[model samples]
Structure formats: C-alpha cells, structure tokens
Target: MNLIDFLFLVFATLAVGGGLLMIFSRHPVSAAMFMIISMVSVAGLFVLLESFFLAILQVLVYAGAVMVLFLFIIMLLDVGPEGSKSSKIKLLSGLAGVVCFGILMVFSLILVLNSYPECSSCAVWPTLDDNNLVLGQSLVFSTSVKSFGFGLFSKYMLPIQVAGFLLLAAMVGVIILSKKFVREGNPS
Candidate 1:
C-alpha cells in the first residue's frame, strides 16, 4: 500500500470510530467531543483528496462553529449522562439500534456493489499537474472563497436568510423558556 492509501485508511478509521463512540457515549459532553473528532477526521480525508478549500471549510464550519454551538446548547440545557430506564425499554432500544445498523449495512453494501466502475481507468476527479496551482488556477471558480461567496449570495440567498431568521428565533425561544423556568422556580 502507498502512503496516500495508508493515510486514507487511518483517517477513515478515525472518522468511523469517533462516530461510533459518539453514539455510544453516555455523557453529552463526551458525545460532542467525539463528534468533533469525527468532523476533524472527515476534514483530513478532504485534505487527502486535494480539496483544501473544502477541508478548511469543514473544519471551520463543522468542527469549529457547529461544535461550539452544540457545546453551548448542552451547557444551556444542563444535559448530562442519560438516566437509567426500565430493562424492557432498554432492550427495545437496543434491538431498534441493531435493526437500524443492519439496514444501514445492507444499503451500504448495495451502494458499493452498484457504484463500482466497469472501466478500470475511470477517474472521479482530474489529476492536477501542480498541486499548488489547483487552488489558484484549476478550481478557482469552482472551489475558491470568491466562488463560494458568489454562489451563496446569488443562488442560495433566500435559504441563507431563512436559516438566519430561524436561528434567531430559536435563540429567542431558548432565552424566553429559561426565563420562564427561572420565574416558576422549576429549573428542571
């Protein structure tokens, strides 16, 4: 195996392991931290694929901003490890999780079987002559900051505005709910 293949395997393993750990973790904070690890590993995989712009954006948006927001929500909600439930409920939940995992595995296997290329030489992306020039010249309009700005403002302006308003409303709601709880002397 080449160095690139080795690195890809490492990052992919880290991403999958982190995801599993996040799902199984009892503590909210631990789960969030594991999610961050998964996000960072995905960014690393993006970098390996030579999508530097995407890698940086993944780190900034998901690992940085999104994770911070999640952590803030957890703190504000005063979330902690899940409490004990009845054995019947726990068994049902475990069975549901196993069934979901089996379904996911079947879908993944089908996708892999269907997507395999018939042509051995099929390339998903063009090979760059100079890696350094990929950002400045090759994919400038496709993956650069300027292109992102243009696309965001031109094609997705409405969605962006809607999302901003939704976030604002959610923040306001959280504040109102906390205040009401405090007034009622029922923090729980």
Candidate 2:
C-alpha cells in the first residue's frame, strides 16, 4: 500500500479507537483526553485530505481550546467516576443502540443504492460538470483561509451567529445550574 493509504489507515484507527475509548471510559478526565486524541487524529485525516486550513482549525479549536474548556468544566464540576448500571438496564440500552444503528445503516444503504444525481435537486446541482455554478466557484470547495473566512462571514453569517448564541446560552445554563448558592446566615 502507498504511504498515504497507510497514514489514512493509522489516523482512521486512532480516531475510531479514541472515540470508543472516550465513550466507554469511566473517568471524566480520561474521557476528555481520549476525545482530544480522537480530535487530533481527525485533524490528521483533514491534513491528508489536503484541507490545511480546516486541519489547523480542527487542532487549534477542537483538540486544544475546546478540550481545555471541557477539561476545565470537568474539574470545576468535580465530576467523579461513573457508577455501574444494572445488567438489565445495560442490556436494554445496548440492544436499543444496536437496533438504531442497524436501521440507520439500512437507510443509508438504500439511499446509496437508489440515488446519486437524484439526491440533490436539479436547481442546486444541475450537472456534475465543472462549469456548474456551485462546482465552478472556488468559494464552495476552496480550502484557503481567506475564502473560508469570506464565505463564513458573508454567505453563512446568520447561522454561524445563531450557533454562537446557542453555545453561549448552553454555557450560561451550565453556569446557572452549577452555581452554589450560599444561604444567608444558615448554619448546621
């Protein structure tokens, strides 16, 4: 196999393995660390895909900044190891998860078997030709930082702003929920 293929395999394995480990990990700190590992591996995959700008952002934003924030939250909340679930509960959840996954896989397989050009509307993607409006424009597919920034600010501004507001709201909710209220002059 080629070096690129080998690297892709390595990165993909790390990404999946880290994700599984993160999900199954009992300790919050360990789970967070595993998530960072998965994020870094995903960044490597992005690098392989030749999207350097996205790769860097994935590393800087997800693996570094976001992970630090998550770790901070975990520590601040003083989270401890998870308690074990009962066997019946675990069995039911596992069965439900497997059934859901099977349904999703079948749905995806049907989509793949049925449609390609039929999936997207003729207006949005008329043809696979390079001369097509969406495909012709570098703005849609370019990996350069300038193009990304321009597109994000101009075309995708409102959704981005909304997402930011949602994240802020979640943060506020977390802070409010975790707030320790000291009752005035109440002693045990």
lDDT of 2 by residue, 39-104 (tens): 999999998877789999899999989999999889899999989889999999999999998999
The local distance difference test score of each candidate is 0.85, 0.85
Compare the candidates by lDDT and give the number of the best one.
Answer: 2
Model 1: residues with Cα > 4 Å off, grouped in runs: 73-80, 128-141, 181-188
Instruction: Show the colliding residue pairs in model 1.
Output: none
Backbone clashes under 3 angstroms, per model: 0, 0
TM-score of every prediction relative to native? 0.73, 0.72
Candidate 1 lDDT over residue span 1-188, tens digit each: 99998999999999999999999899999999999999999999988877688899899999999999999999999987998999999999999999999999999999998997667686766554432323533333343456666656766799999999999999999888878444467567
